[model samples]
Target chain A: MIQFYDLAGARDDQRLSPYCWRTRLALEHKGLSYDAIAWRFTEKDLIAFTGQGACPVIVDNGKAVHDSWAIMEYLEATYPAHPFFDSPQAKAHALFIKHWTEQVLHVGLTKQVVLDVHDMLADRDKPHFRSTREQRLGMTLEAFSADRDAVLPAFRAALSPLRTTLQKIPFVSGERPSYADYIVFGGFQWARVSSERDVLEPSDPIYAWRESMLGLFGGLPAKTPARGAILAK
Target chain B: MIQFYDLAGARDDQRLSPYCWRTRLALEHKGLSYDAIAWRFTEKDLIAFTGQGACPVIVDNGKAVHDSWAIMEYLEATYPAHPFFDSPQAKAHALFIKHWTEQVLHVGLTKQVVLDVHDMLADRDKPHFRSTREQRLGMTLEAFSADRDAVLPAFRAALSPLRTTLQKIPFVSGERPSYADYIVFGGFQWARVSSERDVLEPSDPIYAWRESMLGLFGGLPAKTPARGAILAK
Candidate 1:
């Protein structure tokens, strides 16, 4: 059996992390039986126990797999009958979209989230967000905010190519929801769920596509773990 | 015919990128025929022609595939018999290793090369490295160095888990060079080849593993791009 480690009940919340959701979706796509283990961000030991300090670690038949992209690859390789990717070209294109989604799109959305929605996020989630910012940027909230502010234009500019590419395809890979769509959807959904609805509205087809994805997953569940529950032992 | 966009020949020793080498290695592993097109970094307009701005992109049967990891996936999917990864477990492990190799290891080694080896690098390569730093970090040399200095400890710490994991397994997946080994060998080899002989040291099995890989490839060729050339443009 495949066991998935994530934040408990948080899988339903579109705002937490789409990367985690991608893995969940793939498991569902394969119709694989699995157990879900929820992790708390404040509880660093849970992550370390898995050998990597991150959520969404999948333990399958005793082997531990971290990183959503890696997990998806594992699933695809393990279950070849269903065929997650059809052709070599499609596989490559899917990967390209996945990388861009993680590296570029996530970066842009993170910037928007940290700078634009800081005040609106729940006080409980603020520390987790701030810690992530510090880890990625190696600075305190004040410094990160200043740095994020300075790069806003460049971040927006960097997004043009992705927007262009995404505009051409309904899903990142065109028709079906390949691994690429799962990854991008996870991150974008996180941003949307964590913050404002309008954050994604102006983006057009991407916004529409995201809605479709959420619907496919039976409408992002609102049963996220309580802040206290997440923090408590 | 498969046409690979690459910087073939050693007109400038610094023209090589580890990411490109991974693709080349995969072609060799699969024993595929391809045309290697020599491309200049500045004249990357050809890559831009494919709606992307990165090299080591392969045009397989006129279809463009970008991103080294994605390219490998394309190869594996297209040519399943040769098998870069055999099982889903293996594939997941390969991708897990690939992610670490590409994201963490490459980032570390590139930092060392750009900051410490500037004088030794070819003239054409200097501007490219500096420009990458500027674009990625939005900082000049002094600031970049200071930032890297602050981050090196964390970088090394990040590598410790990987190092421990590699020590336990001969290859990332044990015995065979999966996609992980190909991706990792490229960047790790770059650091080894460009740095001083003892820079990696016998204490680190990573060094021995790297040398083993080099032996597997049978030494860097003396001339420009002929012996190891797997594809043509």
Candidate 2:
């Protein structure tokens, strides 16, 4: 069994890290059973063996792999069945999706739910999360959260590509749930787990797609305790 | 040989329509020969058989297909050689890239070179182009072109995913130039053929990738006349 280091929040099961959610979903997609250990943002020393402070570090048969994308790559290479990428070109294109998710979707979504995420953090993790995110965002968490309502339209507008894509296909990776689906879904899952503020209108195709994703893997992700879910848990 | 209806400017060789460019490139990628007919904005009656006024319409063996995306689909279904998409999933994923290029890249690039594009059009195209565009843009061509310098940064910033992808891979479609590359390169090629203003710094990986794209198929696209090229034609 793989030992997955999952980022936890106020509750041990409150695993709200988007990157960690990607890895967890990838594991489930591969049908790989794992023991998810609840880790906190400030627990850098616990994952020191991987030389990174991230919660997505996975230990499979004593081989440590950190970084969500790297872990997906590792899993695909190791398992070789139920492949995440259909072809080399698919894998390459997936990199663009990954970058778009990281730079565009994640960046847009963070402003929407960062304060809510901060509130969900454990006492020991709050200070570290605040300091790091505040420095990176170049504004206080409250200040970043303040303009979210005003900026919501722009954020939703930026999702034009994703919305258009979903209108054409059922999953981001096409007919089946694959790595690409997991990559984008991670951000939505994070927002869902951390905030009650509905990022998506129920009428949206994306809202429906997210519902189907939540129903996947025998409702594995839906079983997790969410902070304030807008949709049925 | 297929008959391709390509949008032409003042000079017949000045083929600057980004959507049309995608079909042309797809034709080239599939090793198909095409007799490109010069098309103007006001020439709606010319392609009335297709029931649409798009320049990207391709009349293949007496079959008419309109829209750049639909044309590519028709080409793929007809040719089936040198596949544009690796699998159904790749094709599905390409839709997202198509939307991104259309909504994000093309929209940003248009404001930068709309006036220049107007200058490149034939006398008959000017009125229709201006009237339709000005109405859609809610401003005159001159007004839209005014903030090009100020909006250049945001335009460049939106290319973050493409820039990051090109930095890692030689082409947008993994190791080989596929439909995804053509979909995006069409936007750059549109800018190149219409305006002298350099959208990319020479240091940028996208500039290098564009050079490679131009050099493809025995320099077929490079043979076309450009307005005021910053790079060697």
DockQ of 1: 0.04
Model 1 stretches astray by more than 4 angstroms: A1-233, B7-15, B116-125, B146-154, B193-199, B219-233
CAPRI verdict (incorrect, acceptable, medium, high) for model 2: medium
How many collisions between residues are there in candidate 1?
12
lDDT of 1 by residue, B1-233 (tens): 67887653234443356777788778878888887776756567788867877788998887789988789889988987677765443454344345556566776766655454444355665688578877886777556666665666666654654455456556653565556567777776555434432235467777667666665544542122321231222
Q: Looking at model 2 chain A, report the run of 10 residues with the lowest lDDT sum.
A: A224-233
How would you encode candidate 1's per-residue C-alpha lDDT over A1-233 as one tens digit per residue?
A: 88887653233332365677788878877888887665556556766756767778888988888888688788888887666666443454344345556666676677666543444344565578677777877876566556555666666554444454456555654556656567767776566555443344455566677667766645532343223333343
* Residue-level lDDT tens digits of model 2 in B68-89: 9888888888888898998877
The TM-scores, one per candidate, come to 0.48, 0.97
Judged by whole-model lDDT over C-alpha atoms, candidate 2 comes out at 0.89
- Give the DockQ (2 decimals) of all models: 0.04, 0.78
